[model samples]
Target: MIEVDCPSPAKPRVSITYCTQCQWLLRAGWMAQELLSTFRDELGEVALIPGTGGIFVIQCGADTIWDRTRDGGFPDVKTLKQRVRDRLAPERDLGHIDRP
Candidate 1:
């Protein structure tokens, strides 16, 4: 019998903080949905946090994965997924996203 290691239903939570003043709720919601759908098995929860001053940050626990204020740009879906995958399942392959 071949055994495979499947992702557990419970894992670290992810939070996305977006600027309410900047009207980034839709963008943040879209990213949250993408992350949740992609890593449904590996992730426990995805939270959307509203803020001000053009803040757009994505965090897994205390670690900051992406910050628009620091990175000077918003993260694309593939890039965000890759970062999440790196922390959650480093050994897993990301297929097309890994392609050059």
Candidate 2:
């Protein structure tokens, strides 16, 4: 289950994930955060960001407003978001930081 903070029905609980790829972070008992950018992550294919702390806040609410419309059949959105969030988190947690 996803554990998060922020007690508010309107506000989303922040979810921080270590890294699924990084054995170290995963070993530390941290789960990767799922992400879905504002709209049109790129020119074509939907981009995915890393889920560490900053990516899209990134998505601590399990599924944010944008996620509600996301195609549930595809898990890539979450995976990609996590990847981007992890990399961009150092930059003051830029919300909706586009995936490279």
Candidate 3:
């Protein structure tokens, strides 16, 4: 659930791209909080104004794996949708990926 109070408005919606190197990159189930830590205030103008709904997105090793159910913490609907999409991604277009 989003916080009840925000320092400002303008909520930040995020989309994460795993580098295939971040060992932690595994599934969308745990992406939201991960994004909050990774993207943090770096969004600049799109900065999440400490609001009820800010910061979202995540993925796993393939840049698609979606599984926002952490056994305990469940991300919001928007976060879940993105994860599902990444999970259902096309397998052939992955030609751009390279080993780090």
The RMSD of every model to the true structure, in order and in angstroms, is 7.5, 13.3, 13.1
Better of 2 and 3 by lDDT: 3
> Which portions of model 3 show Cα errors greater than 4 Å?
1-3, 15-26, 43-99
Residue 10 of model 1 has an lDDT of: 61
Report the C-alpha lDDT of model 2 over 1-100, residue by residue, as the tens digit.
9985544354333443323343234322222322323222321222234444222222434534223124342234545444444443434344454435
Q: Where is the poorest 10-residue window by lDDT in model 1? A: 4-13
Looking at candidate 3, what is the lDDT of residue 26? 44
Best by TM-score: 1
Q: TM-score for each prediction?
A: 0.87, 0.20, 0.24
Maximum-lDDT candidate? 1
TM-score, model 2 to reference: 0.20
* lDDT of each residue in 1-100, candidate 1, tens digit only: 9996554456888999999999999999999999888888889888899999989999998889999978879999999999999999998888898888
For model 2, the superposed segments whose C-alpha errors exceed 4 Å read 1-58, 61-69, 82-100
lDDT minimum window of 10 residues, candidate 3: 43-52
